[model samples]
Target: MSPQQKALVIPKKQGNFELSSRSIPSPGAGQLLVKIQSAALNPVDYKIRDAGLFVTHYPAVVGTDIAGIVEELGEGVVNFRKGDRVLAHGKFTNDFAGFQQYTLTDASFSAKIPSSESFDSAATVPLGLDTALVGLYGDQLGAGITPPWTESVGESKTPIVILGGSSSVGSYKLVKDYGATHFFDRNLSGKQLLAAISKVTDAPIELVYDAISLPETQSVAWELLANNGTLVLTLPASVKEDEGKGRKVIQTFASPHAPQNNELCQSSWAMVEKWLSEGTIRPNKYEVLPNGLEGVIGGLERMKLGQVSGTKLVAHPQETQ
Candidate 1:
């Protein structure tokens, strides 16, 4: 029998998750077992917890962003070994889960940590980075994804407006990777906002990445986007009907199922690793919780309360075991 390990678990029936003792899984071939040192919670954690349907079974673990030290490498895992620091997306499932003392994952889904970054800072970046990359790069290139959108057009700089510059995904892209030519904060109003948007975009806004779900934001984006321009919204694409005069509306879904569409996920991770090494992307000021699997429940509850803003909520799961 496998040894029991501790984890923060959301019960199948629905309610807040609680810390519990569970089985510690060993790595299978092509997999590595990580001692989960830090994890960042996203809104989906609470959404799934509230819905209860996403969990395959009761007492299931939840957490999608993780950073840790590799404890063991299964057969065919040639790139990593014991004691190497790593980070990964923790899409917990009936098979592959992340919120535990030891979690198993395929080696391809994990990457070596840049020497300059702490696990907590790297922990908050992957999911948001992937969203930003998909918003900017997907559907344009069929192969060989490259950096700097300007490079593709050979000096014809295409301007993009990030709708909610303060959002985790938008802010990271704006302040770190894929620096858009223009950015629009949802908080700005009327003439002030329009002037700022106009100043950033020399030709009125043509491309917009709308992170805000507000109706007014949509109206403003439509008004500014030039005819035949493209818009990427984090919400559903049905929100606006495209007139087809070169205008494209994209619905962004950062899912694990479509690995083909994950080039953005791939490119974003590369940029993050580079920025981490270069000191260009600093860690979101963090409210580091006490180290332990048991500490996650309280931390997640605090996350649900929205106490931490522009700061990541993290826990060291390995210490509790």
Candidate 2:
């Protein structure tokens, strides 16, 4: 039998999560076998628990944010070695999923953790950052903006409003540190938010990144958006895109494995380490859950109930009881 590791798995559709022993998979070409240190929970996790969304296999293991240490390397992979601390964007597939003690990460989807960051902090970034990146830079799946990394995209006098500034994806420190000039309460109603934004800049509110994706938040963002503008959403857009104004609504494709996100992710993934090292990007605030893999179950429940706010929930896989 192959070496085994503990995993938090849903045994069937709408099933409860239980701890089970699963085989530790080997890395194929251009992959790394990672011993997971921390796995962060997202809203999608609870959605999957109730509806089995995107989970095709029975006894499914699912998680998208992982920070760990590289245990082994596959053929044709370079710039990484065994024992390197790394963080990766996991997939829905079992072997690449983050709910296990060990998981496989595509080399292109992984980056070495900087000395300044911890596994817990690094784990908070992958899914959220990728979601924002794809929302802003990916064609069709995103706003299709030209990347600042590719060239000098000059600063705009217009303010880009990002609703839900405290969400896991919205909690992105880059916005506060590098992008935003003003902060507003996320609880503001659409008219209030639009009015506050109008006071900040008269540039027409050309772009809005609605990381919350809730109906109320979407409505506010839509109201604030100007003609020929773009609205980026982490979830499906509930707002209708009326014809002729040239406004586009994009549902961000967060997965690194998606072909539409490939080019944008690759270019950005290469800069992750540098971004962290230089403090250009910062991880979200996170709370460590108890009981390792078992703790993640309750974390998902809190997320489902809207009990968790302004913080990312993370679990230690090695601490599984």
Candidate 3:
């Protein structure tokens, strides 16, 4: 029999999560068997538990933000070796998900965690950054901006607004590092926001990333976006854009496993180690939950209740009893 590992699983669609023993899965080609050290919770996690979105199988394990150590490598793997510390975006498949003590990571989606980063901190990055990357630069599911890594692009002179700058999932501070200036409260009404934006520059809002994407927030983002502009929503777009404004709305799916994101994410993942080490990208602030795998239930509840704010909640799967 294969070795068993503690995992948090939902027994059926929209079922409750419970601690279960699942067999440790071996990695296939281009995959790494990783011993998960940290798993970060996201809004989608709670949604999956409540609505079963994106999950097809019963007794499913979920949670995508993962950080861990490579235990073994499968055939044709060369970028990583045994015992390398890494962070990866977990897939919906139970064997590849992050809710287990051990899971498989595709080599293309995993990155070596730099010495400066910790498992908890690194755990907050994978999903969040991927969403932002796909929203900004992914050709298929995004705004289709030229990736800085792929080509020499000039600084964006137009005012770009990213709603939910402080959300735990995606941190947009990197925009400031390049050329973003001016800050405003996202709570402002659409007209108020438009007025505030007018105070700084008259350039029509060409790009708006509604990372929050709540109905109200989407309304505000759509208000500020000019014709021929692009509005990127992390969630499904709730606002219609055919009001004679050539404004394009793109709902971003950041899964590296998704074919639309594979190439874009691969390009970004290749630079993850360098970006974290050089401070081009930094992890979000996170709070560690207690009681190992069991604690994830309560943490997801807190997230569902809209209680968690600003900080990401992470769990230590190995700490499960």
Which sections of candidate 1 miss by over 4 Å? 140-156, 176-185, 190-192, 214-216, 244-246, 262-272, 280-282
In the predicted model 3, the residue pairs found to clash are none
Residues 1-321, model 2: lDDT tens digits: 999999999999989999999999999999999999999999998888898788899899999999999999999999799999999999989999999999999999899999999999999999998988788778868877787898898875656778877787777733656666788887788888888877867778788999889888899899888998989998888998977888888888789899878888988999999988998788888999999999999999898898988899999999998
Per-residue CA lDDT of model 3 for 68-152, tens digit only, reads 9999999999999899999999999999999989999999999999999999999999999899888888888988888888888
Count of clashing residue pairs in every prediction? 1, 0, 0
TM for every model, in the order presented, reads 0.83, 0.97, 0.97
Q: Tell me the spans in candidate 3 whose CA falls farther than 4 Å from its real position.
A: 173-179
The local lDDT score (0 to 100) that residue 115 gets in candidate 3 is 97
User: Candidate 2 clashing pairs?
Assistant: none
Candidate 3 — worst ten consecutive residues by lDDT sum?
Answer: 169-178
On a 0 to 1 TM-score scale, where does candidate 2 land against the true structure? 0.97
Provide the overall lDDT of each model, using Cα atoms, as 2-decimal numbers: 0.68, 0.89, 0.90
Rank ordering of all candidates by TM-score, starting from the highest: 3, 2, 1
- How much is the lDDT of residue 111 in candidate 1? 75
